[model samples]
Target chain A: QQQVKQSPQSLIVQKGGISIINCAYENTAFDYFPWYQQFPGKGPALLIAIRPDVSEKKEGRFTISFNKSAKQFSLHIMDSQPGDSATYFCAASSIKAAGNKLTFGGGTRVLVKP
Target chain B: DVKVTQSSRYLVKRTGEKVFLECVQDMDHENMFWYRQDPGLGLRLIYFSYDVKMKEKGDIPEGYSVSREKKERFSLILESASTNQTSMYLCASIPGPNTEAFFGQGTRLTVV
Candidate 1:
């Protein structure tokens, strides 16, 4: 029950369009959800995050839409650009997660076409 | 800037050899983690440390062991390097539970 399943292993989006990545979890204990963006030769960095009490949080072009009852959360990249092409990971963890452990999804390789 | 740094960017070792991957964080965070990244596997936690001399096995820790002698440094050791162990290893640190994790560039290990 510690798995976070992500879909659309790979995505291709036209520039100036919207890029969406979806993720689902099986655990209800998860209270915090964060999305990470990783470049080819770099480590992943925190992009945006949300708490279970909030339905959605937006930060510039990146937004996290969370659904508590459905056990799902998604990352929506508005005005997608080529520079946004990278592997995106969605993770879930409880406030008291062991070692602050995060359960990550397999990932989505996003390609923004110019 | 606060950061997590890995000792090596790339490493090559022969099968049956001992391998040690080192990581250090300057954030003085209480939580540190080691994960292996593969093509399809997003990031599999190998081990993590909450404090000095404290360690916990993660999801995949069968052939791997961890050492946390200090608060800022965490090391991952491979008992016997094997070809299957070749992958990108990443280190991360967090200030506390439910916080964002800072990661190192990653060490790509190749076992010959």
Candidate 2:
């Protein structure tokens, strides 16, 4: 069974708009949440990550909104641009011993139109 | 920069053929992982290792095996290739929990 679930297999956004992708997890042991971005033919790279201790994290135009009580997290891309078009994946893991085995969501393909 | 190199970017094999996908990391990370990527299905872990010669099975370990003889190298093996096994395979390494995992370019394996 998939421990982490993501919605909206794909999305389209106009330039300068905002794109949001949401994910949820069932494992209460999970405390680390991260988002990864991947371009065509390239490996997925780390975009941003958040710990349960924080409610939100922002890096430039990318922000991660996390709700620890709800066991949910979302990635919001502000001022979406064509260059921001890519596949986004949300993963959850624990930092305890034998942890860090990332349970990834289904993934969302975002297309930014100019 | 941390580099994880997969032996091949693309590979083709006949059904029933035994195949090996090799991966090497330069960072000497203690943890290594093998994941299978499929559209809509997302990335599924096949196997992982925390130390050399120590391995743990992931969600989809059936029909697949792994080897980690050295600190920097992790190998995925297909005991008998099948058409259902054709997919993109990715290798990743991380220093430890809560750390970034560096991934390889990935290997597209096609079994006919």
Candidate 3:
């Protein structure tokens, strides 16, 4: 079973516009949600993350809006630029003694047109 | 910054050959992971090691094996290479189970 599900396998946004990606998880045990950004031929890097206690968390131009009751979360990138074109992944994890095994969504490829 | 380095950027091997992929991390992390990324499949974990000499199978560990003799190094071994195994392999390390993971560039392997 896919514990996490992401929408819009591909996204196209105009430069300077708002780009949003959404993810939903079925596991209530998950307490941590993280977004990862990946460029071509490069490894994924941590973008932004949020915990269940917070409804929203913002860092610079990146923001994560989370809804615990809905079991949904979204990533918002303000002022989207061509440089922001890449693949994004949403992941969820819970603290476990065996180690925090992450459940990841398929991925969304975003394209920002200049 | 934590750095994870894979031994090869690109590799080509014939079918049935035994292929080895090596990864090293500089952060002295206790946990290391191996994942394979494909066009639409994203990243699928092959195996992970939480400590030296300890390994756990991930989602797709059928033909893969792992070894971690040292804290900073983890190795993924392909028992027998096949064309379907061609994909970009990534290595990652995290301080522990609850922290952010740092990833290596990747190793693009093509089994002919």
Candidate 4:
């Protein structure tokens, strides 16, 4: 079963507008929630991450809003630009003796029109 | 900067051919992963290795095998190429399970 579920497989926003993507998980043991951004030809890069202890974490134009009670999280891009168009993935992980095994959501493709 | 490098950017192979995709990390990371990217499917883990000479199957390990002979190198082997296996393969390495990861540019493999 897919542990993490993401919504809105694709998104489109105008320049200067806000772009949002949502994800939900069934496993509460997950302590780390990270967001990754991928360009057309490049690998996915770390954008922002948050833990269950905090409700929100912001980095530049990218923000990760997490709700521990609801078992849900969302990524918000403030003043979205065309450069922000790319694929975004939300992942959940819990550390283990060997290492942390991450479960990723399907994905969200974002398009910002300038 | 920590980096993960995949051997080939693009490769084309014939059916029934044995295909090897290599990944090397300069970060000396203990955790390495192999994933395949498809439209809408996101990144699906195929295999992972936590240390040298150790490997574990991930969510979609069917028809795929992996090797971690050394700490810095992780290889994914396709016993026999199939058209269905055509997709972009990505490799990632992490210092620890919960920390940030370094990813490779990806290898676009086409099985004809």
Among these predictions, the greatest DockQ belongs to 1
Tens-digit per-residue lDDT, B13-105, candidate 4: 999999999999998899999999998888999999988988888989998999999999999999998999999999999998699988999
**What's model 1's overall lDDT?**
0.94
lDDT score for residue A38 of model 1: 99
Clashes in model 4: which pairs? A100-B97
Superposed model 1: Cα runs more than 4 Å off: none
Reference contacts preserved by each model: 0.81, 0.65, 0.52, 0.72
- Every candidate's DockQ is 0.87, 0.78, 0.67, 0.80
Worst 10 residues of 2 chain B by lDDT: B93-102
User: What i-RMS does every model get?
Assistant: 0.7, 1.0, 1.3, 0.9
- Against the true structure, candidate 4 reaches a TM-score of 0.98
Clashing residue pairs found in predicted model 1: none
lDDT of predicted model 3: 0.90
Ranking by DockQ: 1, 4, 2, 3
Give the CA lDDT, 0 to 100, for residue A30 in model 4. Answer: 92
Mind giving the per-residue lDDT tens digits that candidate 3 earns over B14-106? 999999999999998988999998765767888988889999988899989999999999999999999999999999998876679899999
Local accuracy of candidate 4 as per-residue lDDT tens digits, A1-114: 878999889999999999999999998889999999999989999889999999999899889999999999999999999999999999999875345767789999999999
Better of 2 and 3 by DockQ: 2
TM-scores (chain A) of the candidates: 0.97, 0.97, 0.97, 0.96
Write down the lDDT of every candidate, Cα atoms only: 0.94, 0.94, 0.90, 0.92
lDDT string for model 3 (A1-114, tens) is: 677888778899999999889999998989889999999989999998899999999998899999999999999999999999999999888886354666678899999999
Considering TM-score, where higher is better, how would the candidates rank from best to worst? 2, 1, 4, 3
